[model samples]
Target: MANNFLRRVDLIFDQDCNFKDVLKSTYQRSNDDIINELLESGLKGRGGAGFPTALKWKFTSEQADVEKYIVCNADEGEPGTFKDREILFKVPLKVFGGMAICAKVINAKEGFLYLRGEYRFLLPELEKQLAQFQSILDELKIDFHIKIIMGSGAYICGEESALFESMEGGRGEPRNKPPYPTVSGFRKKPTVINNVETLVYSFMIFRYGAHKFKELGTADSRGSKVFSVSGDTPKPGIYELELGMTVEQFVEEFGDGDTKAVQVGGASGFCVPRKRFKDTIIGFEGVPTGGSMMLFNSSRSMYNVLHNYLEFFEEESCGQCTPCRVGCQQLKLGIEAVKRGERHATYLEQLQKLAQTMKITAKCGLGQSVANSFFSIVENFKEEMIY
Candidate 1:
């Protein structure tokens, strides 16, 4: 808890990197050396899932297939999340370098960056930096190369399997699991798909060494995360900070004086009311996020907040599974009914149960995680949801 204070870290945005130096240093290290460092550092997928980076690369590398792929999930469609766009904008090269390193670890000759459709403006500058990067790879004789592809702004496409489907010229829908991306991904080959910030941290871990990274944050959540702070905040912008801090500490720094609740993730994430702020830690040990921290003040309506998020989930659901597709619509309608006094407040208990069922039966993370915000808001702010 000593390190839980909101100390700002500048490793990702330092701009002190020379990709050649990082990659050249990488040239001397074997795949085991690279993977071992990642494992030691405990670097997880910063895309909110928190899967270990080392295992994704190691598992993909272990596949017998000769045609493995590495993908950067750049679909920044999560509501209240915009750090990925900033990372790509301010430090495109680091993102590329991170992908290159992963490509090497998995023996991948080709990598793809799935850029969000709205970020098309970045392609020109990204291409220039990428060409320069590939030339350096050519000079070093590294066998990796990367290409850029644009997304269609489907929120579900942010899921790894759905993104793969879109990349394969099919609809962006999530595939059933057990055969994850590491086993069968784009083209049904072995793949390692990491988020934009995840890749940047991978590169930074290599550049700064894993021990230094390990020294920060708690045991379960190692290293710093880039957070997109907005809504009822004095300082509403991107800030990289160490993990394991309570929501209270966060509100103290970023919250407007009248802050009432904080949405730790995005629309699909949990809503922490002011009462639980002191007890809630914003990490895997408590509530984990994909780096979207939206603060709401007392002036705002929790009912409206919950409504907006439910509507987003209802509209964005791919509608593949009944639990998710129908669940979202019913949840929205359920709350509306309660607000209008059309249903008894006790009906919310049934709706909460429905959300819990969706958590179990929903096919993808999109439908599954809706329960997080639903339960958190309804349980804590029950009065608002009713009247």
Candidate 2:
């Protein structure tokens, strides 16, 4: 397990440019082979959902010959997820290379990096890196050019469809699914949207064989994952751990001695208390995360944590849909009411039921995932809310 523990795909991380030579070999192979390699690697999107990267590529590739686009979601809006920001700052070429490879597979001539507005400071340097990457594409004669699209600091735009809407110069509200991004996206063209880490992993998986990449992680979740650890951790920083490690293992390695609960994603993820940490695995099999692991010690207040998260979601909701806008408000108020003794304990039960309804009926992932942290924190630390 330790051998697979720190399996860093260091080609891009440490500025190893040898990946260009590896990509040159891919030009001779057919697109199907490349896509199939991704399929076999069992790589999933690192952007929370854990959707199959290969399937996204396959669907977009199989679409009718039209103007297709590849989008890299660099909108690192999640509270604790800054891994994408680091990748965008340091190893942008890996992102470009991955996008180029996806373009080659899906026959897309253009790509976009939807950068979060908070990261606008990194733009000047990123443009310089992209210019260098463009020359490499020119040398390889790959007919792909990546453009940078800056988001206006809207957290809802982190959703692919909302990002698409923002790219089109509209308000960033999520579109309904079924005609998902693969079929109709970004000006109604077939588009493939991947998070920053997912694109980098795609680059590595293509260079190293799928079997080699598959050797690292568990059966359910393949490949190593980059976790951004914070909050009461001794070593609070970015960690590249092989997926499927128990929460207990992670806490033991990084916790600041008195860790009591762990938030396994950002505000929109699950909270694992000390009792469940021993059995909890941080992967798709147990609790899948989009690269955030915030450890909370016993000193922290669960009510305050939930309040902070609720405040974030409340302000970030696009307000276009009633369920999200109104539901988030009610959740925040319900928790506050409980904390202040203004409402009976049964009020929380009503809010939980409402949260269940929101999960089923909300517009997109933002609204749907609000219940995750709400329920986890409230259910685990009920005493904190009441008294």
Candidate 3:
């Protein structure tokens, strides 16, 4: 009930002035100061991983590499998620300012916003706004620059390494991690990959100071997050909520009638039955903060929903690795078998084991999290899976 950064969305629209200008004026500190403030604030990545943002920047900043890069992962291919799209269209300048600040902090000369291919309609509009921002930067003599790279709509590219490969004009398949993007990303330079919402918050953190930013959200999860609620929700758009808001409150506010379950964090995120929703809260502390929530009512068929999700994964896989390519194929086959009442209980057990193995052995996050939706839905709603 208390208003914090969650309600800033309303303020942004209600106030007639430019939100970018307000942010620039309010948070325009030197790069060093901004980085220090962010470190103190304990801001973690709002994207799926929830890595500490300050530590990520510190790693890149301290690295002895000559070339450094910052990338905004705007490739929002996760089903039921559209928060990044809204930010790109509604608050383009803030996204730009955040990237500029990130570049300055890491002393990176260049940045890129890797947008999904489906966002073709927004490209021209983004280009126009970007040009306007460029003029302002030129007048101000800022040395940093950003290019908008369009993705081929591959869900795998949402993974950082895959995004890097796509930027290099190759197929959008994921690469091996450990040498990670921080040490060797984007043409073999140290790079920082952040979500669109995470970068947008950077401008706010830089402007308002980290301590003030910390004042809003929970202790561990320290910020507000934007969730794109779809499916059975009545107001099925974006809602900015504090990190720790319970799922019950979220569902009651926007849920359609007779809500049965909710999927937090997107296609790769877990599904919670109505009973679990009451206890769960939004944030990286417990539940994931992947920025997508699809509510389901009793009227909705769990099998159909999961089938749709699996179909998405089957089509979007980059097919570079055997586990992902073959595993996803097997999963799809298993789903079809179950649907047709041809799968034995033993086959279902095998699918579960395969899901676990894929989580641990997959080449990247795509293969790792791919089975999440299936496993969660099946485990929680076993009754629905049977004829």
> Clashing residue pairs in candidate 3, if any?
27-207
Ranking by TM-score: 1, 2, 3
Tell me how candidate 3 scores on lDDT. 0.80
Task: Mark the regions of model 3 whose C-alpha exceeds 4 Å error after superposition.
Answer: 1-31
> Which ten residues in a row are the worst by lDDT in model 3?
5-14
Best by lDDT: 1
Worst 10 residues of 2 by lDDT: 3-12
Predictions in order: lDDT:
0.92, 0.90, 0.80
Best by TM-score: 1
Please provide, for model 3 over 1-387, each residue's C-alpha lDDT reduced to its tens digit, 9 standing for 90 to 100: 443323433311122445446445534566567677888887788778999887788789888988899999999888888988988888888788778878877889898999999998899999998898888777667777889999876788888988899899888877777898889899979999999888877777665567766776788787677888898877887877667777777777777768998888887888888888778867765678578888899998898888887777778878887777788889878877876789864677788888888898888887888778878888887767766
Instruction: Give the per-residue lDDT of model 1 (tens digit) for 1-387.
Output: 333488889888988788889988986899999999999999988999899999999999999999999999999898999999999989988998999999988889999999999889988988998898899988998888899999987899999999999998888889999799999998999999999999999999999999989998999999899999999998899999998889999988887789999999998888999999999999889999999999999989998998999999998899889999999999999999999999999999999999999999999999889999999999999999888
In terms of TM-score, how similar is model 1 to the real structure? 0.98
How many residue pairs clash in model 3? 1
